[model samples]
Target: MKAAAYRLTKIKGKGMGLVAARDLKQGSLVVSELPVLFIPGKSNDLLVQEEFAKLHPKKQRQMMELFDVNSTHGGAKTPEGVFITNAYRCPLGNALFPTAARINHSCAPNLTMTHREDTQGRAMIRTACDVREGQELTLCYTDPWLCRQERHEYLERMYDFTCKCSTCSLTGEAMRESERRRERAAVLRVKVAQNLAMCLEHSTPEDLLTEVEEALDIARTELFCEPTIPLMSERAMVLALLCKKPELAQKYADETVRVRLVTEGGHKGLERFRQYAKCPSSHPGAMALGVGSLPAESPDLSAAGRVVPPCYSPMSVVPIEGKGMGVVATRHIIRGELILDEAPLLSLTQLDANLIGGSGASIGSLLLDKLQRISPAQRAAFWQLRETSDSDVGSAARASSIFMCNSTTGADDRMHVYLFGCRFRHNCVPNVLGLDTLSKKNHMRYRAMRDIEEGEEMTVAYVIDDHNFTMGKEELDTLLEQRRVSSCDCELCSLTGPALARSRRRRKKMQALYDESKNYYQPGQLPKLKELISLIEEDIQSPFLVADIHTMALFTALEDEPRSDAAGYHALEALKCKMLSEGDHMGLEQAKAWAERPALARGEKGSTCEYYKPLEFPYVDRDPDMPFAVALRQHEEDVQRQAEEAQQKKAAKKARSKSKKGGQKKKNKGRRH
Candidate 1:
């Protein structure tokens, strides 16, 4: 109805073509119209003739006007031959739109076509990039990723014409280089697909990310714009779900939406990306990959007017009688509950004692230099922490002592100081568990080991080892005194003679059972290991120790019988305990897979176990969202809905055409009477 963006006209060598009547921007709709005839399934001479007869007389004339290269090139002059030259393959079927078919072919096309089944089988054409007023609009009929020689040969064979597009017309070294770039892109595309298919099984997230990046690099260099959209989307998902880097995930998602808008107009796919760009954790895979284990916010200290970010913790700093300051819970906290997840206020690497000039004074000066770069509010927070050094020491020495007292080892063995974390006092037997330093490099995470009542003091072990759990009351007190701490006063440490000795004996025996199980597998040891696990749970209630015992039991079960249900159950128990004790760690993904399918632990051949059943267990209490199975089910549902809608539209269109032809037949019969 409205003026078309392009006009149909004749070209000197290429017969009829569509040329832009006015300047058009990228993603602008060029033409939208229902196909003259829609043929369901594969197009053939018989099917095309049957569908063509159902079209209105005027629409049939329009279809006939479309050029048929096969007829002009000494081939059969049939409706099917014309359909082969013009029909666009879509989810609905092979659609033949008279107006869109006029757009000539080019190896490098400026226009892209999308069939919208929701709009009563409308064919929509949009410019992939800007086009000049007099430029001839074109679309690619063959696969755009094919090399130039392949593209030309296919075009000549199928349509009886050689493509003269700029990309296909390159000469000498330029032509060879273009082919090289395309060939490299093809190789990287295959590698990316293989890696993604085997992700977390044979390939790591890093491997997939690397191959995707290389493919994108080639796509951009070769000016192959279509592949960039999906590649960017994949990179964004991998970063958010696998790598657990929200900032980088958001960055790539935003880029993907922007590129898709220019290449393929707005669609439902872009809406998904927009939501992901706003908050990457909302992605379904984020829950499965434990993305919530990482800190939600990472502040930028480089910005102007930067200040110390407010802590989002459940505890408050309060003074103790002997201890200067300590954090206490304001509300009841559950076991495995994330108590504190905060980025470090300041981070400094531990000086290597083996360095040539490493000294106490040198370390103090280095610490002071790093301190000066932080914001003023952050610096004030750092100094407010308790300093254990003598009053006669210099400022740098006092700062170093405060750091030593408060900071904990992080990734790369660096010292990371947290404002709220440092306020918590230490107990030899602690109620909270800090994730291992090597697990997360950016943020320090602390989760409760056991439930605590409101107003209870939140404590963590400054150092946890065999001595903390296995030592007696007197010996433990002596060790704490040597470390410049007070005597044992907590519930476990306050035990006098008999209770303390029994506790020590149970812990020592538990450790011995764990060691024996790991050294060799024996049928007699299973009951002993299970008994020790129950004893530790009833007496110690230590998640780390429980996880260690379960891990040994899992492997022992496998060594006994690889495909037993006990092996799967123990693997799941071990995974759950590790998640409760350490949040997320290396080999966690593999552990999760093995817990779900124990046969994966054997080899590839074990995947075909007919008796195998996936072990089911609730995830850790930290995240309650749908796991991988539910997410996969949702994806399948969406695909099924699209297919059903396409089929419904096709059937409705066919009924309308049949009803119109029946009315025409009745009118002709009345005229004959």
Candidate 2:
């Protein structure tokens, strides 16, 4: 027999109530149970009765004893009433968890009855906070956010019980103070919403930082942190990145994960952030934080390297031959220039899901509310957005459709619909990069990767890895076809026949070489890294790919000597590659910083590397005579063979497509007669 952590006991006035058998820590599981009976959301009386009858008589009796139907209406004998009074609104529906239902309601509940599905599909109740032995466990029946009076009225009308918890029982000044704070929080929401927009669109980093700070202040004043923690965490990271403080950004990223664990609980949305937290440098521009200053000899490579020039603004929006409307250079924009810093017209995030679709409110209502708050000019700009084929037929749905279609998702899970940023056409091999300033909640910054001549069309990547330089041509084309975007006419995308085959072959060789060298930690591993570096150097067309390889090489080199100068060289090489290909401002700085002092990259002094483990490298544990070098060679040969096979298949597909097109044209000509 399974031993329970809690037991049901008769209380003086509250009928049967749950009492904790032992003390439990916060987040401890108190009960894991399946519902005795369930009424699939708002079922009719006949259906409810039929489901109830299907249950065993013993289980049915247990549920009936939990709630009294006669108390509401004398001798009515309503089984549905009994079930309704006791049922818990779980992920499934209204369910009668015999043990969970016995736990009485409180405005301030110690135990949070979350509807969590286990591997076996059983619903579990976990303690939100600590509960002492013999103390009565309670859960909130209605919204815990309601004011004292509102809670009283809600409880009276819905459950026919008056809440007398510590919060509800507060009297005099204490009660008034609590209510005042709640009112203040409600009022601050309008300002927070407005400022969030401003933060996204600010021209200067300082102004953007100011707006973010203001939002944080308001969130702190709210008293409850659950609603605003995610925003705060994201802002902290953005601030750190902007200020060139990677360590500080990492701290906030850790907090973001912690808060998500407590609130959202195992959400798939958190994985991207977790990866960022684990390796902040993996981000394109994140390396800039590592270096305090740019080298004197180094060309002004990014807007972050110096103050933005006055003329650096939206020069002109011009139509391209193949691509749609794109931002064009009016003057000679220097390498590492700030071309545009425009704010989003409309921004939507997962945080706004409830406000948009939950209960009485909707996306249209929320969009209207936000639209009304902004200036007339901003509203006009929003309306000017070119509606796509997916725009809804109706007004409300149309506004939502326009926003959704135009908006682009950022790292923080926000969808920002920009006025100017969206105009820049998509290119597989772009000369500029768009960076999300998470600190500002809803803003992105565009920086020049290289010097732009007058009349040149400025372009940014639509998908981060969806490019001929990064992904295979086939994969790139498939994604473009899905998005309904124009086929990329970039120099790299136009490769055909022998030229395309040669590029693919080089890329495959480089990939295989990288794979072979990345894992080995032996003394002989340096030779493999040298080979990989040589291959990367050979494929000089895409420096972005080279930078990533060099970064890996730098890490591998660091294992031999904690403060190896060789690692520093690789870092600088990687930085140069990144700057040339993607204008990675952060990567440039990080490389410079690492070159100056390699010790900082190695955790604290005397401490082991935080990012890598000795166990992962076989040299630390494996026998000295292990044939690590031979195995690596074998792996490289195998990878090369696979790459050759893949290339042959690709060639076959292209030939088939060409043959089909020629046949179709001939058939069409015959039909014209």
Candidate 3:
């Protein structure tokens, strides 16, 4: 009995089209009507004719009144032609909806259609986003991930006209960029499918999580909302079942349901997602994965608020003397306390170099394209960030520079620019431990490395590696210079006299021991590994490196005859270190499992533990005292020397051949005389 939200109208060049009857908010229902005639299986002339004859006389007339492009475009006025022109695919089969058939196609559509079985097999159309009055309602007819050319070809072949939708009407570089994004999206779609399949078999949960997060990033960037619903659902399932993080699982499930409601009114899986959101352990997959019915509670941050804004709350964005702006603690914060957890404003995955530059696409061009597509608020937030580039550069170049200066590698290995997270100033030795939380949540989490008082500025290491801990002050400065960092005034960087020398000596020894541990295990390596742990703990308070050292110690302990008690101890230490480095999750779970059961340390293949193995470090034989840049230049010189030597040999061989030939000619002339 409710009035229709849209009225049929003559669209300028597109014949009949649906236009909004009034201003409609997102998710508002535009049409819900049962089919006038429903045909089962693949529709053909005979099938359509049979279905049409079965329809009531009034219904038949109504269906016939609907626009038939096949007949109007010089094609035979057959019943099947009209059926193909106006029919919408339903759960049972192809169904002809008189009202819904009038909707036009747009590459960037504001409306979405779904078949609703709950409403007695009625076709439902809803606004994907807000629509103003008199706005033409449209839905994408072909695959949304298809490139513009492919889309146009399909539309022209299937329908009788070429699509001139707003997206298709784009010209020049803008159009090429759009096409590239679509092609990339399509490739990523296939990758996601393959990864999901692999996850069900040989792939680790972490690998699948990374792939899903990357796919979701592209989907969000491209405004491909429908694909995200399924991705979020999968993410929730994986977090709950495999990862055993119920709280995160619930969060994703809730998000999935919200997105589903907004995009497609509701899917059949809507109720299931709601259940998962309410109780993640209720899912059958959780039981199979041995996940217990744990309460879905967020990680306790104690006094820290669950969510803090970028501007203020737990931390205040304040002006530092040298640094333009930096985050400062507003209150006393305890060690391991969560300081801030924020999502990225912009994210980009690592594309192949060929793909990045093949089609005249650079990071700057891609960034500019992304900027233009983002919401006004997001764009404003991005622009508000510090721009270290020259002010006179073009917008694309400017965006690229801003991104380069502030972006950090996320847990998924994608580059992300966080509005608030990037505000924390960089220090060689920092007071805060910032990590991209290792989940599909894609949050940059900043935790306190040590307790701090109110008004203290929060700082994090811009880059963390063996170099940060092992390199001396001068070497550190050289490395930072290479990275384009201005300077560091952190406590360690400011050390003078004996304090500085001792720190350097300790780090040098640590680096030596670390490199030794990476090679084939030696007879007396256990003591050296223990020393490395002590050095790391004393000199640098980084739990990640500490965890790495502990893992090495565990490996050494496992190699011993009958595996000593030290193996279990080191396992426990590794677990504690991992917990500090990367909150409670699957990494902690594996470490706990190893710690609880030392027998598992022997590992199935007898080489190393099956659950955990240290990553291999490629050996680069360079002098310990040499700066990286100097070593690089020396390498280039060595390469040039080899090239020159090869050239000299070739020239000498040619000269000897010429001399021999001249001598042979002289001998022949002398003989003739």
Candidate 4:
């Protein structure tokens, strides 16, 4: 509504945010506002500078004042860095509603964003996930190339602050792992094209027997690693290039053409592919092998660990008050499961991120209304969930569906871009499970853990901070001092001051270990023997000790002695066994040096540290401090080892006696006894 209570406000660690004036519950619709303004870049070259100049000076000043200028990198104008190097954005786009903007920028964002377009050509901003009234709403800008150093510099410049986001908070091995993923992404693009082609070209009827079998492996690998929307377009291209079947290739090519027209508009870089997208059947690259009529592969949803469950989604034919009309969930859900699957009240490509700001840009929001208007068949599900607001009906009706029912992010996000069922934000330690919906209209289905305590605020984690995803003491401290806002004073951090003090100590100690381990690991090299020890220690002590413990062990081992130590041997053993079991080639190569240790020196199968199953003894509940599980496991191992040693000694003695008797037998035979 236009009321002051629903107004957007500035958040500190979180960035420009929205605060709830009145107490709210899990599924309550908090606020809906028309974007203060939307500056269509097509109309103005210097959209930001000129748009501000046109605004009332007071409002202009307010907008300018909110500029997170430090987002620029060395004054570079990359859209992403310029948006928010710190915790904010360039403040120019039309946001039908942006409660999510208040959250700070993090490479690893918990919240998501989506744009909902309705049948009447209207558009709305939506949360892909839930948010709390007081909690800072965070959304990843989802821009590639925003690596650690660049983000830090951008934040330092524009927001006049440093980022303490989890991505930036990694230390030692964690930092290196992050670097690996980023670098690997940069190099893997060309490899993907070649690899896909290799599969198609290298195979013959004598080799693989069929086209589908030949291309399946390549498709599997490429899809697994960062299959953004652009890649999906690329996949369509690959299909046309590599497939033997003309009809199948043409079908995918049509999608590529459609997506390209909607997103990139055949711009300079994209213009090159224009011919291929359109000329699918006759493209120069179409398989000349005459291999058409091969069997087609079924949609391998589970190939990439993705589940594409069948949809029994019900639709609504009513107007959702703020976000237009939609259906809401009537059932509870678990992570990675379907909550809703509806055809968009509307669907098109201009809604894509690339299309939104570039030429034909207005096309993105121009026809939103054409998509969302519903049909009569859904009148049942439609009427079932539509809600109206009394406070300001006009503004509510005009609000963006994404902001009202979903979250906003980039054009191509699978994890963060929510549909209708994203209004309910959870506490860090939540009691309710948030379900996934695949349409513009969905609902928050809250199921009780026990009996619902009538007024309980059902919530889920805004950021999953459990598993203590930290690297070192400094990193832990940095995050601990971050925006850890919580309403629950009953938890450890809020309840006892001394508990926090002890935690800081543990964190510091753990950090010391990480730093030491990082020094041992070589960039792109197989981790040194020392490095293996470090990762294992961190893995073990993580969550159980201060955040820094594991990394600290690795770091110390790396510097103290890279060659050999019992702990180093064991760490290498334990980690390698895990990696090999999990099929991690990189890990095996890195930990190779320590891998040569005696099998007994390495970890045992039934070790106490293995918490793979529920145990009965040393009851973790009765005495949390005592690691009876470990002690008992080790004791059992020691006993077994001793018994084996005794048997070996006895066998050796008997063998020696037999050999002596054989030597004497020759003398006795010669003598005649």
Candidate 5:
């Protein structure tokens, strides 16, 4: 009954069909309903029979009405032909809806059906274009751009009907002209896809703007309306963000929403673009590429090195004793001190799916284009990067290898070749740390994780995470050796003789302890964790691992109902370790919040967090040393007290109402006035 936008009517030669009840605009909701019958598999005659036999007589009759018993094409064989002709695919099955079954097919349809799960899994038919009153509502069973010959064959095979639509009925030169238009559109489609990929991977803001214009021109040539040309609107949004053009982004974002409503029924990515449209600068990648540079300060001299501009100083490029060139501190640098702030000279991203993994020509062109865009000085610096042992490689191979060795991937799947930053060589246990803070308006910056002596070559971990530390030593050594262009000569890697055996033994014991403690159920886990922490501290400066230990320690302390001070101390320790690691991930943020107010982080009596065993802790547990923690405990107490008072008042009022109702009922019964 809710599918009321159209009414069923008998149409000439087309059997029963749905016609628009009134004049309707494009993108207007026409009808939405759940399927009446559903079954798995395409040619499931058994399933149809079994399912039909179980249905009530009235439902059976309803299904019978949909199929013409007399006609060969109309379910005359087994009543399954009707379902085969009409049912659409859904999860685990094909679904048949009663009201929608009446809607006949058309090659040039005014309505389009989009299956949606957001509205409780209802399949919706919406107007693809404006429709006049009494006009038939139809949906094309195949792609509208299919050639006329193909459309005819597809329709005849699938639905037992020949298409006589406007495009299909054309003859002679008209038919040839339509085919030509389709052929041209198909060719342009590939070009448009390539352009979009290039824009995402290699184009500047200006290039994205050009793509938008070119796409619109192609769409116009193909006689595509605004709703049909989705890419033009999408590219405009991306271009707007890149150029910090919020208003333009919003305009295109809204257009995209409207177009999606007509064709796809909804767009899931709308929310992200909507937020970007509202404030383009709020996006993580907003204006990250080719923006104005930060102001440069004159080079400052320190004890052993000089800090230089654009690269930032007390840092200088120097050759290491056994390794290649690396960055070194001129002065003694304290922990957490910023080492350098630098942007890449050239950044490249992957090409589109169609262009990727083909001949190396497309990727080579992209690399050359990026090189040309940079300043001559920057280009010269990029060329000065040392050649590897491989020399017989071709131009494409050489370029790709250079990037593979020197470039680092950052946010947005971007591979950046830095003139200076890439010089900081790999150390499994390095003292320096590097991270891309694109959202913070700093593309990439390096900082000291520990105190650095003057004239020491600053190094960062090449494998950025703790995975290698977690692995067994032999496996880790094998994997690292395979990946290395040269031998790793770091303190841990260079060990040999009995010392190497002892080191491996300690690592094996440490990993075993770490594995046991990670489960939180091992006997003497606290003592074993202490031993693990001592081992890790002795081996390398892995603050990330320290942070995990402290986080685990906090939960372990709380579970034992230890003094809240000990819990708070563990929380603070974890927070400090995360800060030292220079990580701003969700885990670090949560740790920081927990350290600030331990009581709030702990669950309340009936809160949703109560069901989570990990979050369950005594709310009264408060660290007396932490003023904010004490304040949070007091606030929660007050809230709980207020909630109890409200409950009491409600109960009293209910009791009074019950007593008054009883007295009134007695008085109405003439027992007492």
Candidate 6:
């Protein structure tokens, strides 16, 4: 059964895959193998150059010792071209063995990936999913970040094949819809970033506490649009810590860490998140400490390498040279195996220089240069580890830009990323879930919708809610063009005129409603709150709703139980759920957060003064369409009636006083006469 790793067979152009040569059970072991290659991205570039130059003097000997690297992407019959055409490129100079590289390409896939260290102190891969016999195993051909054309091109140019995957099949309006979703996601990300920057900039510990109490509304709002994206929730927790609410920060941090670990496989990038969960105030990148002082931990990548096993595979969304890149199984992978161990090619510090070129040129080259410009010792050390730029200036810049754009670490300060997994192609719906395991413990796993056969393509979603809401055509065209894709075929690429019109109208209405609800919510009307709820419900069906369901739930609960700790905590779910039907971010921590504060009454009888200050921007008024206005009116009437009653009571007292005074004066005058 252990040798069943040989069960992977060939299907010609379909590439090598796992076949259910027989039936398999749950928790069964699939193919697993130790990786044939190892590449650590650690170096300032000088080091790689120094090492490489060492052999330059012995060209013949060096060529024989090192595997041939083919830069030519074409039809040359030269030995280098054939191998270059065949060599499966991975992180740094690492390449996968032919056993794993022979797999075919697919947009939809069956298996998931996970990696850990075995008793030998070496990283190992094990099955996280069940596989059946005779199923063709395939890997993703493009990174999730690439647009459709980029993916198609990558496969064709490098792998010499064109993709007929589901994502590639979608054309016209459907593609646009997918792009719209991506764009909306990007926009929401910006908004979240903006809010985080603001909080980190102005808010002090006291300010953080109060703002945390309030800004959670926005965090919850953004969660609806992208629940799995942990940045928003992480920021919200950061706010809590700023105000010395360690427990609240710890709670939210736990969630942020969990999501980062599960999806990203616990690389260093997720370590701070893990720490933040355990010790929110102390974790690096804790905004409460001032985003400046709290720094993200970045390690030098030179001379560091993680040995992967054959069973682990990678899924990607990044573009490759020529034919964009995609995910590929690194070995006859078990359900879980070490697909790829990777470190950041370049890490930008929090210093101002990091902002140079806007990540425009090859950051790998730029960074290496910076290291060289430092003191002689530092430059020499950097030079010793660095490798020359293999790409032209534009490509170098693009590569640098790509790295910077996609290089984000979770709350966990450690920088982490899987080389192979980073190559999985993009789709609105992904089958694999990334687990962050590098710095902290990662739980990378893949579940099969059904029995997976050998050589079958395994895929995970790049974006969520692909089935219902997709991107707009303009978005698709714009992004694809920028990424150098000919066009797009995502579900939302093209649409009928009516459908497009409807989509626009829905987006407009949702924005309008969101504004109205935000404004109307100021007085904290309880009964009238149902109006905002209804409006949100109506807007939920729209394709362009920027925030996610979790965000909506958090905001709703905040309104429902203002000044109450119970409700707020219930809605701060930072996890990325695969099942889209989730209504809200409900859980234990949220409940605790809400429970801690207890509820406070808004106003009482004869409470005529407006003691509450209106919230700042992005915390808009409540929906005008809701019953809030009428409820506010009713509350006002009740207050007015109480005022009248108080007035009458005071008038009676005044009259009695005047009468007593008059009687006393008359008696005195009579006595005097």
Q: What are the lDDT figures for the candidates, one per model? A: 0.66, 0.59, 0.66, 0.37, 0.61, 0.40
Give the range where candidate 3 is weakest over 10 consecutive residues by summed lDDT.
294-303
Specify the highest-TM-score model's number: 1
TM-score of each: 0.44, 0.40, 0.42, 0.27, 0.42, 0.30
RMSD of 2: 27.8
lDDT, candidate 1, 1-673, per-residue tens: 6567999899769999999998998888898888777765456677789888878888877777877877886766667777878889865357888888899988678887766424567877888778999899998898776898888889889888988888888899998988888887787666554323224445567776666676777676555456344544544464446666666677766776676676656764455457656876654334223343222222211112121121212465656677666777655666766677667767775563212134556666766787777654355556656666663333777666666667777656777778667666777668887763554445767777787776799898765573234666677667554334667677777777999778778778876766666643565566777887898778667777787777667666666655557777776777777766666546588777767766565554353332344543234221233232222233457689989999999999999999999999999999999
lDDT by residue for model 3 over 51-103, one digit each (tens)?
A: 78878888877777775667766766666777888887765458888887889
User: Of the candidates shown, which would achieve the greatest lDDT relative to the real structure?
Assistant: 3
Candidate 4 TM-score, C-alpha based: 0.27
Total backbone collisions for each predicted model: 0, 6, 0, 69, 3, 179
lDDT of 4 at 570: 41
User: Which wins on lDDT, candidate 1 or candidate 5?
Assistant: 1
How many angstroms is residue 217 displaced in model 2 relative to the true structure, after the best TM-score fit? Answer: 9.9
Tens-digit lDDT string for candidate 2 (193-268): 3332244344344454455555555444433234344555555565567666778778877876765555445644
Q: In candidate 2, which residue ranges exceed 4 Å CA deviation? A: 1-3, 39-44, 68-70, 73-77, 116-122, 186-252, 263-273, 279-673
Q: What stretches of model 6 exceed 4 Å from their correct place?
A: 1-6, 11-13, 19-83, 86-92, 108-138, 171-174, 183-275, 279-281, 287-673
C-alpha positional error of residue 469 in candidate 3 after TM-score superposition, expressed in Å: 3.5
Model 4 agreement with the true structure over 1-673: per-residue lDDT tens digits: 4333334666665545655454433223333334433432122235445544555766544444444453333564432222232222222224322333344565654333332222111222223223445654344554533467776776565466677766678899988767666655444433333323234444432232233322333323322212233344444444544435556555555655543343323233344345445655333222222222110111111212232211111111122355332233222322222223222222334244334235332432332343235332122122222232222221323222222223322223422322233333333334433432333233223222212232233344444443443333345334333222223322332535777676556545544544544543333223333343354344322122222233334333433444535334444434423321222224344344333322222334433222232222222222222222233333457689999999999999999999999999999999995
Note the residue pairs that clash in candidate 2: 201-343, 238-439, 287-586, 288-586, 288-587, 301-336
Model 4 Cα shift for residue 106 (angstroms): 0.8
